[model samples]
Target: MNLFRHAAFEISVASPDGLPFSPAPEVAFAGRSNAGKSSAINTLAGHTRLAYVSKTPGRTQLINLFRLKNGAALVDLPGYGYAEVPAAVRRQWQGLLEHYLTRRENLVGLVLIMDARRPFTDLDRKMVAWFGTTGKPIHCLLTKADKLTNQEQIKVLRDAKAEAASLVGNITLQLFSSLKKKGIEEVEKIVGGWLNPEIRGEAS
Candidate 1:
């Protein structure tokens, strides 16, 4: 069975105080606006609209949570790096992301989404550095792999792995394509291990 297919919407938190209390583990999905973050999430959940796919960037303004069947949760953070969004709103989102990533005890790992053609932008690196401080694992998805050629995919994967090696903490990278439905199992295996450590012994 697909572990993430049973995911269902739980809540959307606009402020730190509104964050829910849960005993189950959580995995956060974060990326720049329009970087295919929502699409990747919906693909993983095996639902068309599990996470909203918007043509406009910065549409995911709140911290959204989705509950899995086993009690574990998936967190869809507000996308960053959209210039058109008001500066005040961007600052608020930044605060929310920092607070949750650093302070949430139930958070097990992070699934960082990046466009295959443009992996590891300055903002993405900042996110890695922020979450790396927690010493948790991060699995990066280079989304929109379908947009790249076969050779381009291999080159990007190679370069991304090399770049990720310089980042702090345990990080893994893979090419993903929501249009192609690729790399879903890889994400599931990594995230599932974090949510159920006993089953896999530990997160890689």
Candidate 2:
């Protein structure tokens, strides 16, 4: 079954304590501010307004949860690396992220998004490191891939894969373009495995 198609907004959490005690495994989508994380979620959902795409970076300050009909969930974490926000707020976000990544028992994996033109910024590396310690799966989606040439895209993909090889956990990556709807099925298939009862166990 198409799990993403069954997705619906569940909650928006600003604090770690706001996270619900869900038994279903969660797949968290994360990225730098303006890296098309929300757009990627909407595209995967096959719904235009499923996730709010904002022009201003750092606008998504809450951890938005989308529940699937099967009970599994997709989590949209607040984007990092935008400095216009207050320093204290950034620190708070850091703490909230750390707490959720390490303490959320239902979280099964992470889907980190990055711009294809500039993959693996400092904050991205830090996020990868933080989650890698848990030894969970991490799949990076290189968004805005349509902006780059085919050759450029391949090079970025190769480099990103090579970098993932050195991370602590099972880190994989692929080229994705929300604008062009590229790799939508492949991503959905993978994420679907995590949400499907009969197949989620095999996903790990």
Candidate 3:
């Protein structure tokens, strides 16, 4: 993927009678609130507002699906943890996320976005467990790489790799910064490979 020309749009599930099935291969982006998931997607897709940018954390309450030119789908899942949403609304997103992650057919891999400064939180571990159960490739994206020094970024990557190893066997970690546009090429290459039919292992 060029990382500069992919077209994307928001997707909504009008009815909950199971997810809207799409034949396109799907790769999901998931993380905690304020983890920069939307920013990462917008960076990769080369658009400022391809996905919804919300000021309130955990405002993304839907499993957003963006179609790529290669007939693949980029899914943006709701951020988990510490959202001030109502109990019932939170429960709805929780179930929706669980169902999509565990049951979606075209789900090829998961891009787990984590704040580079706080990479290995409890919520991150939980996501690892969920991805493990699904038996899909988990790509650990350490976002905000530009915010940290080079030494700190290296340390964070090392620690995240160790933690992910214990949680999920097949995992890949990348240093990313949506603001600086760092790691954009690397990530786009990985995503392009994952969307391809031949590459096995993880989408690193």
Q: Report how far off residue 149 is in candidate 1 (Å).
A: 0.5
- For model 2, residues 1-204, the per-residue Cα lDDT tens digits are 456775899899888689889787899999999999999999888889888999999999999999877778899999998999999999998998888888898888899999998899999999999999987778889999999999999899999999888778878789999889898877877766555666656654
The local distance difference test score of each candidate is 0.92, 0.87, 0.79
Q: Evaluate model 3: give its TM-score.
A: 0.90
Give the per-residue lDDT digits (tens) of candidate 1, residues 13-89. 89756878887888999999999999998999999988999999999999899999888899999999999999998
Query: Stretches of candidate 2 above 4 Å error?
Result: 196-204
lDDT of model 2 at residue 85? 94
Predicted structure 2: lDDT: 0.87
Worst lDDT 10-window in candidate 3: 10-19
- Could you tell me every candidate's TM-score relative to the true structure? 0.96, 0.94, 0.90
Off by over 4 Å in 1: 199-204
Q: Which clashing pairs does model 1 show? A: none
lDDT of 3 by residue, 1-204 (tens): 473357666466632343566776888899988889999999888899888888789787777778777777787888888557778876777677677777777788889899999986897787777777877778888998999998998898888888877786468889999999888878777777777776644432
